[model samples]
Target: MDVLVLIGRILFAALFLASAAGHLTRTKMMAGYAASKGVPAAVPATIGSGLLILVGGLSILLGIWADLGALLLVVFLVPTAVLMHGFWKESDPQTRQLEMVQFQKDLALAGAALVLLALIAHAGTDLGLTITGPVFDIN
Candidate 1:
């Protein structure tokens, strides 16, 4: 169970980590995309979001302040989904469908992040450790 939880954390963090790397490496491209989506201060926002994602992903991955990390993810995902994936504003059916898919994906991730935050708060400890303390407690 501990191993599974650790694996889940790693898997959850991987998406944000990879995305942060992409945002940093492809800053110009990401900024251009953000600009097309009408994001104010697109370039700076891209860079800032990259940093936020990096910090959040690392915190979650390391199990250090996972609650804060989850909150960061919620902050990043909500605006991003609404701003970048505005399916309702799309006129083209294909584009609308694609944007809707992305929006749904973002919402799902946000939900997962919220769940993680709730779990961390409920457990009153870092999620890296077993909720019951010992990993293999049989009692």
Candidate 2:
């Protein structure tokens, strides 16, 4: 399980790092795409998004602020999935299919991040330690 957690962290870090680098290196293209998506203040948003991705990715890679890093990623990617990938009517079927697949993958990754964040936040609580009470107890 520890190995699995480490693998997840590494894989997620790599994905974010690649995405951040892409966005940073392609600022103009990203801005254009954002404008096309009807985003207001597209240029600034693009730049800010890139920075958030870079920072969050680095945090994950360094294993520092893992919970906050995951939270930041969730904040960035959830709206991204919605605004960028949710609507598909304008796209060709093949493109839409691919985008949908990517969106699902992002959603899954975000869900995993959230789960990891929760676990990390509850670190002191015995994950396997059970507490008994009248009716509402945690185990």
Candidate 3:
């Protein structure tokens, strides 16, 4: 069970880590997309979000401050979903459906992070690994 939990954390963290890398490495491309979605100061926002997810992913992957990591994920995920994946704004059915799926994905990820946040907050040292750390003993 513990190993499974670790694996889950690794998998979850991987998603953010990969995204962070993309956000950092492909700043211009990502920024252009973000600009298209109506995000102001898209370049900085892209970089900033990249940084946020990088740190958050590290925290989760390393089993340190997992609660904060989960919180950071929630912070990033929610607003991005609402602002960037605004399916309702799309005129074409296909585009709208795609955006809706993206929106739902973001929401689902956010919800999972929120659950981790709540669990970590209560579990403290115990959750330091999955919920917080079997590593640095930091939350």
Candidate 4:
């Protein structure tokens, strides 16, 4: 279980860090995309999103307050997956198909992040404090 968690952490960290860097390095492109998406304040939105990804990715990689990091990721990803990637539901059929595919891919990544968040949240809750199936100590 520990080894699996470690591996999962590494892969998740790598994925977020790479994407964070991509956004930070391409601020203009990101801002342009945001503006194209009809974001009211594209420049600030771009910078804020980039910072969120960078800081949240680093937090996850460091394994310090991972729950908080995951929460932050969820905050960013929900909007991104819904707004920026809403091309599927808002665009033409031809464009929608392509965009929907990309949206689903991004949604998958967001889903992974959400799962990690849930795991962290469950770690200390009554939810995580349960076991099922046969047990010798059952009485």
lDDT, candidate 1, 61-136, per-residue tens: 8777777787899999999999999999999999999999999999999999988777766655434453232221
Model 2 CA deviation exceeding 4 Å by range:
1-4, 124-139
Better model by lDDT: candidate 1 vs candidate 2: 1
Off by over 4 Å in 1: 126-139
Question: Model 4 misses residue 75 by how many Å?
Answer: 0.5
Clashes of 2: 0
User: Whose TM-score is higher: candidate 1's or candidate 2's?
Assistant: 1
lDDT of 3 by residue, 59-131 (tens): 8887777778888999999999999999999999999999999999999999998776676566666543443
**Model 4, residue 82: displacement in angstroms?**
1.7
Off by over 4 Å in 4: 88-91, 124-139
Question: In order, what lDDT does every prediction score?
Answer: 0.84, 0.72, 0.85, 0.68
> What overall lDDT, based on C-alpha atoms, would model 2 receive against the true structure?
0.72
Candidate 4: C-alpha RMSD after superposition: 7.4
**Descending-TM-score candidate ranking:** 3, 1, 2, 4
Candidate 4 lDDT by residue in tens digits, 1-139: 6456556767777877777776778878888988887787887887788788777676666656565676678788878877787875665787787778777877787788777666655553322212221111111
47-123 per-residue lDDT for model 2 (tens digits): 88888978777766565666677778888888888787764655688888888987888788779778766764555
Worst 10 residues of 3 by lDDT: 130-139
Candidate 2 — which pairs collide?
A: none
